[model samples]
Target: MSQIIIDQLTHAQKVRILYKTILRLHRGLPEELRDLGDKYARDEFRRHLQCSPMEAQLFMTEWAKYAVTITSQLGLKGKAMGTIGGELDSNTVEMLKEDQVIQLYELMLAAKGLEGDTITAKDIHNSK
Candidate 1:
């Protein structure tokens, strides 16, 4: 049953999984090295765009091994960007709410005709 399910995945699905794993690994890297790692991964995947199915399968196999090794080495475990239930932390949630409040306040002021060019400039200055 499991083997049948695995066999049913298309090549594109496998590639997407490999790509997302690489990106998650990249996220765990140090800030200074993140860009370099991301660029390398992106370039490598892009370079292989023209590969035959056998070649692509071989490439994905190698990358899957690499992803496992990198995850173990870096102690990275969690969902990647496209995974389900990717919720923000509490601090981020609060910050987003605060931003929404400010935007709503500005909108209210605009709707009331209280925000002309001069008033808008004053509001912006005061908000800062």
Candidate 2:
């Protein structure tokens, strides 16, 4: 749907659409990522259930972008399995708040099936 039409939707309506869209798009993902993506999307949405209106707007916008991005990648001709989206660029990472960066790091670990492993400032420093 067009941006204008989407903008006309109520918050709840938008939420339902985007939430279903993301989960549905996950069906096109490789098996491992599909499971992880489904859980992550559900957790994120549930966590934001009572967020402020401004926060809700930002949340929806980002997820909307993710939907568009993944849809395009999945639509590619003869796309390889297990290859979907690429890594976040440095500039994007630089724009994230500390908590978001930490969440991103934890997500990376989870995606690698390395649960319970945590990073520290020392580890980050040593990696440089």
Candidate 3:
């Protein structure tokens, strides 16, 4: 979506569209990753349901970047089975508050666990 179109949307409209877009794009990922992405997005969106207006704006902005980055990665890779995560901007990480940073750290751990699981599954499949 263009900035012009985005500019016309109300906050609620933008939030709804961005959240749905995140879930929709995850469809291109592997089933396990897709399920994780869907659940995380849903939970995060719900957690922010009562945030302040400024907080909501920041949250939407970050997720919008995430959606675009993932879509770009999927396009470049011709699939979403591997290495879809681009390096996160250091500046963005530095800007996160303490609680947000903790949440992000937990997410990283979860993603790492999934990576190990995927590798183990592939090893077993190859062995068979």
Candidate 4:
């Protein structure tokens, strides 16, 4: 379908955009979904990369999905944290905070097309 094509393009663009953003954010795509975590996932990703093209495609697709989901939630969470007067300091440790984690997640998600534009707590609340 044409919609699917459009969707694919959107995702591709998101991935490219997020690639740079992720570098700045100090977060890489989650390793678990990318099969880059533990021995199994890493092995799987490697095997896919070395073997069947379809498998490679699947691997990338899964990573993109994971990235998007994580980023969107991260952004939403960050907005919430900001409301409470909490500020995130620069460091990987700070990434553990729910709000900071969410913002990182949002940046990734926007790159993947899971969500777009800036979101606010009210936007999230209204949606639900």
Q: Which candidate leads the pack in TM-score?
A: 2
Candidate 4 lDDT at 55 equals: 54
Arranged by TM-score with the best first, the candidates are 2, 3, 1, 4
lDDT by residue for model 2 (1-128), tens: 89999789898998999999998888887788899999999999999999999999899899999998888788554343456788777788778776777778788898999979988877554533
* Per-structure clash totals for the candidates: 0, 0, 0, 12
Worst 10 residues of 3 by lDDT: 115-124
| Model 2: colliding residue pairs | none
RMSD in order of candidates: 17.3, 2.7, 8.9, 16.5
| Worst 10-residue lDDT window, candidate 4 | 77-86
Which candidate do you rate higher for lDDT, 1 or 4? 1
Q: Any idea how many clashes model 4 has?
A: 12
The better candidate by TM-score, 3 or 4, is 3
The residue pairs in collision within model 1 are none
Q: How much is 23 displaced in model 4, in angstroms? A: 6.5
Q: Lowest-lDDT window of 10 residues in candidate 1?
A: 79-88
Q: Give the per-residue lDDT digits (tens) of candidate 4, residues 50-125.
A: 5566755665676556445545644443321222112335564343555545555564565465766676667444
TM-scores of the candidates in the order shown: 0.53, 0.83, 0.72, 0.29
lDDT of each: 0.63, 0.84, 0.77, 0.46
> Model 1: per-residue lDDT, tens digit, 14-86?
7877798788777776554456557657877998899998878777986887787666666425423332112
Would you give me the overall lDDT of model 1? 0.63
